[model samples]
Target: MRLLHSKTLEFATFYGDATPPYTILSHTWGDEEVTFEDMRFIQKRKSLPEDLRRSPEFMLAFDAAARLLFPPNRDPEKLAGYEKIRKTAEIANRRGHRYFWIDTCCIDKSSSSELQEAINSMYSWYKKSAICIVYLEDVDISFPAGTWELAPGHLTRFAASLKSSRWITRGWTLQELIAPGRLTFYNKDWEPMISKYVAAAAISSATKIPPYVLATGQLHRASVAQKMSWAAKRETTRTEDMAYCLLGLFQVHMPMLYGEGQHAFLRLQHEILQNSDDNTIFAWEPLSSPMLPSIYRGLLARSPEAFSSTSKHQVERSYFTTEAKEGIRVDLEKAPLVLPSGEVYYVAILGSANGTKLSFGDIHHLKQFYMFLKQLDEPNNGRRKQYVRVMGIPNNAQHQVQHNILIFHAETICVRQQPIIPLNFETTEFSRFVLRPDTYSATGLPDIQAMTVWPLGLISEKKEIMIPSHSKDFTALVWLQEHFNSSVSNVQVLLKFTRFPRVGYWCDIITGKQWPKDRDSVDEWRKAIERNHSVKELAQRKRYRIGTRSEIRTVSIEPGIHADQICLFVNIDGLII
Candidate 1:
């Protein structure tokens, strides 16, 4: 680490345990900031080259440094980067500290190893600092005389302005604000604005960072989501620095890759996952409105905006466990079925609804899950109670699946007005629905041929149901085809009769395809019944008028009934009888 002599303004490097107590400067970077090389030339009284002298940033630095060093005829106005550096040194000297560090001039960023070491150690450096001087360049310190004590109204306005300072929104300043033991804020004129102890509440409100963390520097007490929310609104000049700046907050380090773009954040999440098991890290929603068949669904959050509302919630790591053998596997389990064409399909089961619970609260939590449900094509209605099950195929096998499954508990939350306690349904099961290799197409719609639903357990009799692969109303079919589909396979299709909460359209038909042998018998029976006009007319009477509107007509057919006799029957004495 390099520290500047408070009185002499000469740079000196300190290593190991010999480093002296130093004050650090925390401020937003300006175009005219002094760099290590610039400081070296300034210290030797050497004239900068023509190009350097002509540069506005260099001129600004020269003027600010001249004002402090010569002071006798210095301009009162035109203060710039050097003024901040000078003010920091003067303040340190006044406090009897001989060494101080300014980011712009302290570390030589030209060296990659030095840059990486500085960043990885930045949080600790700030925490161990004797003091942190925060300069809010945009805040004005000129108030009416004697009102310096600050009337209640004036204080509120001052606090509000302080809260909105650009100093708090820079990516690098986040750690500087939280890591330092003692911090003092100053305005443009180098006048004291507020201290960490005095403005904790206002700072918390502005940054969404907890006051406790700011006060005690115990950031680990906050949840991962909460820590992420603090950076939700912060930004950096380089995209990757947004993640690099946060290394200290999470206390994890990795090689710095400047040009990696958004993958830097993904890497950060992977590193966090290795050291911590906080599932809430995955609990973020996209900032843009969610769409069904969403493109944003993934294991890592795209940005900090996803954790905007999670700052207030307390998350327990114990809520998640790796008890189930299937739980530990990162890959989705492929369905164990083969297409009639003798082709294999790859299935990837993303997430299931069986062990998960759902509830209604602030729209925030719904948005979080909705963000996770990016595979769906439509956004969930915020007003309704929603339950989502997410499933996906691995990228290698994604082309083999028609569409990923997004199973909602019901069509609308109002159908089950009473909140389902624990929200776990015995019949709910999630499985990957891989499409036949021959049938897979980029433009093809998802169908049941490529997907299958299985029962959660053997508590109840299960049956299988097949439908046309090109069906658009699969959500409705899954609900209405419950009984008929249940008798053939172990899968229980649980569908409830309810009005469409979003739109008033009603589902009328519960369609299913029987097994080959059973279908043949039904076809033969239908032909035998149609041979009689009386039986045919009775069967045609299944159509009914449901609503008051003349156009509202529905064809309601009860499954397992043919010619007014039960079509599906089992006799204890003789099964065929």
Candidate 2:
């Protein structure tokens, strides 16, 4: 059958014997008759939905109504274009009620009461449609002429039309961006594609302008609601027709929560009726407009084939057992955990493993390991002491430590690092000395052994000397100068602390008292502690070492006794300037 219709062809031949309940109505000119066909169809189709009332009586009433209280028909071509729309509506109705109630054909023209009732209930009808076909025939449905079947031949045309269409390219039409949340309308510049089609239809009908073409006007004379009303009066069927078309085109082109099937039509009607108003425009938004688009996009991105399948998140599973005294270690260097369903999770092992020992990286690995251990039904049980030995490191330094294990909370992650680098410098008497103690305590160090180095800024071994969290940006720099500077600008100082105390609960090695070896009182060291502000310039200090070979010799002023003092003083600028 030829797709295009000649201008204003009378439907008398189609209705000649097609009895009542089948009157043709143009949704654009509500209750208004098209030509004189209504007089013939009135008795036959008068009992149907009012939208079908293209009878002369309905038009007369509609016209009289407009003259009484409503405005004039400003959009005449949109009025004349009604017949062409009715023809297109015929094409979408072929599947019986498989596509019944195709609004354009079902509404009766002789009954204004039915028309009013239908218009008022329009939202529900559109929402419940079996197959809402959006005849973006106004925007050119992508396919060859007369081709509506799903075929390979239609694919190329579909792609090409989509690429060149102003709707998709400029993102300016209802069909192009119908996400869930907010309703959008295109501004004028991108109106060319659809407007040109309506314009051509208007010209063919020998009309000056269509109602929708008034959308071309720069002035915003009508509120969106008012314009909808105008559209409604022109033709209730076309109003709902286009709205259904827009909604259907949206479900097809953009993201929708449902998939294709027999239910596609039902879902379309539900969505359209739920969202549209009596004027056949969108209703007030039901969801948060901002989040609606995201939901829409998500629906679009979903793979339709997998809609009914179970999801497998990329997570790994493992099981292991360890002995009480000797630990059993399984290296996880980029290995996948195998599962019964053939699923796998990749894991990378950071290793330098030993029994009961945990390194800093090992400490982090323990948290995940603990979870795995619990999965295996094993507990810590307080029998094994965890130890960490630095065996092979990039720095080539070997050190060992017995970790004081504490139960870690499930939600808490690893501790944060401090600014100072831990100086494990080897001294002659004591092999390793931690110059900065703040770094140790931040990592939860219980205590430090051997050589004592007290940083002057620390109030005690218990507290750290760092800028407070709430201070303004530059406050740390200001505090740095107060303790170290006589001239503030160029002065430098050193502060140190021992993580391990020597004798009492809180005691450190002090000078200027009796030496443990010689028992001689060194008064010179006492004078240095009193001058706490003195900047140490290392270039001027006399450095002496004491101790035997292979027994690391440390720098010393003189051997002093360990004292029961809560804190110690060290002028670490190397030499007082």
RMSD of each: 18.9, 24.9
Model 2, range 2-96, lDDT digits (tens) per residue? 01112222232212223222212112223432332332232234344666466678777655654553346522224433443444345334423
Instruction: Give the per-residue lDDT of model 1 (tens digit) for 468-546.
Output: 2223222212221111222321111222121122111122221233323222454553343234223212221132221
Error of 1 at 214 (Å): 1.2
TM-score of each: 0.55, 0.22
Q: Once superposed on the true structure, which residue ranges of model 1 sit more than 4 Å away at CA?
A: 46-79, 142-155, 291-296, 319-577
Error at 483, model 1, angstroms: 58
- Which candidate number would show the highest lDDT if scored against the true structure? 1
Deviation (Å) of 173 in candidate 2: 11
How does model 2 score by TM-score? Answer: 0.22
Lowest-scoring 10 consecutive residues by lDDT in candidate 1? 568-577
